[model samples]
Each structure stands twice: as C-alpha cells, then as structure tokens.
Target: MSGSDIAGLIAAGVFAVLVALLAVPIVKLGRVFDELRSSIRTLSDGATPLMDEVTSTVSTTHEQLKRVDGIAANVSDATANVSALSSLVAATIGSPLVKVASFTYGVRTAWSQREDSSRPSGRRSR
Candidate 1:
C-alpha cells in the first residue's frame, strides 16, 4: 500500500476511536434524562391524590366556618334580647323604688322637725 493510503486509514481509525470515546458520556446523559422523567411522573402521580384530599379538607373547613357564623349570629341575638329585658326590668322596678325611698325620707324629716320645735331649749329666746 502507498504511504497516503496508510495515513488516511490511520486518520479514519483515530476519528472512530474519538467518536466511541465521546458516545459513552452521551449515552449516560440520556439515561440520566430518562430517570429524571420517571421521577417527575411519579411525583405527579402522588400529588393528584394529595390535591384531592386538600380540596376535601378545604370544603369541610368552609362548611364548619359557616356553622360557626350561624352560631355567632344566634349568640348575638340572645345577648341583645337579654339587654332589652334587663332595661325593661330596670324601668319597671327602679322608678317605683326611687319614689318610695324619697317619700320615706320626707316623712322622717317632717317628724323630726316637729319634735325638735316642741321640746324647749335651756337658753332663753332673745
């Protein structure tokens, strides 16, 4: 064979070796991508059930909050009724009690004044 032919064969062999050397890393990179895809799919599969459970939990919480609001409204109404009832009682009983107390005080004052005037003092009147 000629020297040119030998040189060409050697160059082709070198290029083939280089390609084989580089192909190992490319194949490993492809495998890594495949594993990553599988992991993402698994995560998506797991998240669907969790999302459904969360949705149910949120709906139940909303229902409970509505019940609490209703209970709070009922309590507010009861408090208002109690306040109105207390005011009515105060108006009904408090005014008569004040009038009776004032009447007793006036009668006592008049009785004391009459008794004091009737009793003579030791000092003579000027």
Candidate 2:
C-alpha cells in the first residue's frame, strides 16, 4: 500500500476510538436529563394538589374570620344593651334609695340633738 493509504487507515482508527470514548458520557448525560424530566413531572403533580389544599384552607379561614367578626359584633351589641339596662335599673332604684337614706340621716341627727340638749352637762340622763 501507499504511505497516504496507511496514514488514512490510521486516522480512521483513531477517529473511531475517539467517538467510542465520547459516546459513554453522552449516553449518561441523556439518562440524567431523562431522570430530571421525570422528577420535574413528579414535583409538578405533587404541587398541584398542595396548592389546591392551600386554597381550600384559605377559603375556610376566611369563612371562620367572618363568623368571628359577626360574633364580635353580637358581643358589642350585647354590651351596649347591658349598659343601657344597668342605667335604667340605676334610675329606677337609686332615686328611692337616696331619698330613704337622706331621711334616715336627718331623723338620726334630730333625735341625737334633742337627747343631748335634754341632758345636763357632766351628768347621765339615765
């Protein structure tokens, strides 16, 4: 054979060896990409359900907060009603109680003064 044909054969052998050496890493890279795609799909599937559950939880929380607000309003109304009722009771009962207390104080003061005046100084009336 000629020198050029021998050199061409050697070049073809070297190129084939290089391609075989590079193919293993290329195939492994393709497998890694496939695994990554599968994991992404799995994560997406899990996240969809998680997001739906979160939405439902938020809806329920909003409803509960509305109910709590309504309860707070009811408590405020009850407090106002109780305050008005207490004022009404005070007006109904306190006037008579004050008058009676004032009359008792006056009677006690008058009786004590009369007794003191009727007794002599440094002497017991009894």
Candidate 3:
C-alpha cells in the first residue's frame, strides 16, 4: 500500500474505536432520562386521587361553616326578640307597680299620723 493510504486506514480505525467507547455512556444517559419520566408519571397519577379527596373535604367544610353561620344568625335574631319582649313587659307592668307602691305608702303614712295625733307626744311603747 502507499504511505498515505496506510495513514488514512489507521485514522479510520482510531475514529471507530473512539465512537464505540463513547456510545456506552450515551446509552446509559438515555435510560436514566426514561426512568425519570416514568417516575414523574407515577407521582402525578398518585397525586390525582389525593387532590380530589382534598377538594371534597374542603367543600364539606365550607358547607358546614355555612350551616354554622346560619345558626349564629338565628341565635342573634332570637336574642333580639327576647330583649324586645323584656322591654315590652317592663313597660306594661312597671308604671302600674310604681303607682300601687306610692298609694300604699300614703295610706300607711296617714294612718300613722292619725294615731300619733290621738296620742300624747311622749315616749310610746313598741
């Protein structure tokens, strides 16, 4: 063979060996990427059901809170009604009771005065 042809053949063989050696790491890197993709898909699949349950729980909690709010409003209304009723009862009974108390006090004072005027202003026995 010629000198240039021999040199060219050696270069081609060296290139082939280098390519073969580099291919192993490239193949392993591809498999690692595939495994990562599979793990991500599995994680997403598991998360779907958990997210759905969380949504349902949140909805149930919101509904219960609404019921509690309604109960609180009802209690507030009842309290207002009770307060109004108490004020009405006071208006209906308080004035007449005051007048009756004043009348009783006047009667007692007049009777006591009459007894005192009929007696001397001396020490009286209890």
Which candidate gets the maximum TM-score versus the true structure? 1
**lDDT for each residue of candidate 2 in 1-126, tens digit (9 for 90 to 100):** 999999999999999999999999999999999999999999999999999999999999999999999999999999999999999999999999899999999999999999998888895768
- Model 3 spans with C-alpha error above 4 angstroms: 99-126
Kindly list the per-residue Cα lDDT of model 1 for residues 1-126, writing each as its tens digit. 999999999999999999999999999999999999999999999999999999999999999999999999999999999999999999999999899999999999999999999998798788
- Report, for every candidate in turn, its global Cα lDDT versus the true structure: 0.98, 0.98, 0.97
Query: What is the Cα-based lDDT of residue 6 in candidate 1?
Result: 100
Better of 1 and 2 by TM-score: 1
Instruction: Give per-model TM-scores.
Output: 0.69, 0.66, 0.66
- The deviation in Å at residue 93 for candidate 1 is 2.5
Question: How many clashes show up per model?
Answer: 0, 0, 0
